[model samples]
Target: MNEQPPGRRLGRGLAALIGDVNSPTPEPANQLAPDRTVPIELVSPNPRNPRRGFDEADLIDLAQSIQKHGVVQPVVVRPSPDQSGRYEIVAGERRWRAAQRAGLAELPVIVRDVDNRTALELAIIENVQRADLNPVEEARGYQQLIDEHGYSQADLGQVIGKSRSHVANTLRLLKLPDVVHDMLVSGTLSAGHARTLVTADNPAEVARRIAEDGLSVRQAEALAQTPAAERPSISRSAPAAKDADVLLLEKKLSDAIGMRVTIALKGNVGELKLVCRSLEPLDELCRRLGQG
Candidate 1:
């Protein structure tokens, strides 16, 4: 049994609500009066954990720290719905894994009686707050919440303490193709580069160039904005020109929204086009235009 004083109730603050394992001042997510310390074997990792990849070197370092000085904070878990006498980890998976690597028999835990929704929310919040999830993982988590729980961008932003626009932009990374996704997950492409390539004519080809040339985000955006036929290929000529004033306006708009903007004018009766690769960017553009 976990050691604790009688009637030592935990609070429902964000630290507790989010299951911050590394919280300097730990607290509980609810009014649950008691906390328990369970055997490490009984505590299974959450399969739905938003954080997918863990750096092996960092894990080793964490294990060494645990070996020197045991787990400072307790992991948060919930009763497993599928198995009796088993618990599912809601947060602090890294700590638990490190403890196991450090050869620990048991560790402290706070077993909350939260439902599936709360469990997923807590896991996402914990990973996001700690900056543990990578760009792909972060976007996937947001998408999962939106898809599985019917969470709107505004609702997710409110819950995660972010602006809806920020949440929307982060979620846009998922529109990247498989090649770009691998590049992003492996750190070959930055979030900025990935976002710029979303609407490109050939994202995989452009992503290859970006990686081969070590192009910056701005450079990638410039390359993506260029017409495919006039992209300086060995077989292609230069691109057609627009009016100088129209070009200037397009540049301004593109810079403002971090995406491509185009204007076509025949006699002040032409169209203004804002090109967005995904719903997130479209939402961002709409928000900027005060239309969202």
Candidate 2:
């Protein structure tokens, strides 16, 4: 028999693995199935789970909902390899956390007999589908899968339902310094801003300036592209003061086009520049201008 390509082999069982985890609405039969309920203490989080940060406020809100209605969806788990009679959570860690907060003694779970690889895949799928993982977390997850399982970026894209470029761009975030990674995790910097800093001479310093000055992704990109020798002066010297009306117009234009806008005035003739971080936004701006 012929061997399947690496990407195809990696992507083979992803659809079935995602199954109900990707579903928005909970199936009635699966919810609170008596046989699926297990003691809360018996279920532990997967250490390899891609999602590291959980918003406390969001968790509190979920806990309140769980208290009112109980857990409507079952978390996915597998029999723990290290501990006998215990289950390791593959998905729904947030739900598990909220259930604990709601003082639940038992949790509904769908137990599957899966190996380490499949467990990680399920965790990533569930989090990515929900947009729960931050860029840093998502990138780290992809890196882990690649390092441990011989997965190519194309394989990851196919498995995660993302474009190959998207996977490649996300993986680029890992090249940033640890301080920059901290910024990303704390929401002090965005994926776009972080991406531009990947090849900068001093990413942490650039990231700090980007955050402190409230620079747009486009501005960050320009700053990252600037030479190290001139960066200090650029950081120190603020933009020329603008009239209130001009600033307001820039903001309006930025909001309207969903990109950064700058206006430079020289007498009656002036320049208005729209800064897009990616081709997609540029295309959208072109479409809008055409319609006008």
* Estimated TM-score for each candidate: 0.70, 0.74
lDDT of 2: 0.80
What lDDT tens digits, residue by residue, belong to model 2 across residues 1-292? 5756545653555434434434344345423343379999999999999999988977886787789878766787889999999999987798999899999999988787899977887787668766789999999888888898778898888767789999999999989988999999999999999999988888998899999988888888889988877864334356678999999999998998878899999789999997543223454566666668
Misplaced by over 4 Å in model 1 are 1-14, 18-34, 232-292
lDDT of 1 by residue, 12-61 (tens): 33455444334323334522332767898999999999898887866786
- Candidate 2 contains a number of clashing pairs equal to 0
lDDT score, residue 248, model 2?
Answer: 98
Clashes (backbone N, CA, C under 3 Å), per candidate, total 0, 0
Candidate 2 is scored at a TM of 0.74
- C-alpha lDDT values of all predictions: 0.75, 0.80
CA RMSD, predictions in order: 14.6, 9.1
Q: After superposition, how far is residue 276 of candidate 2 from its true place, in Å?
A: 27
Model 1: per-residue Cα lDDT at residue 289: 60
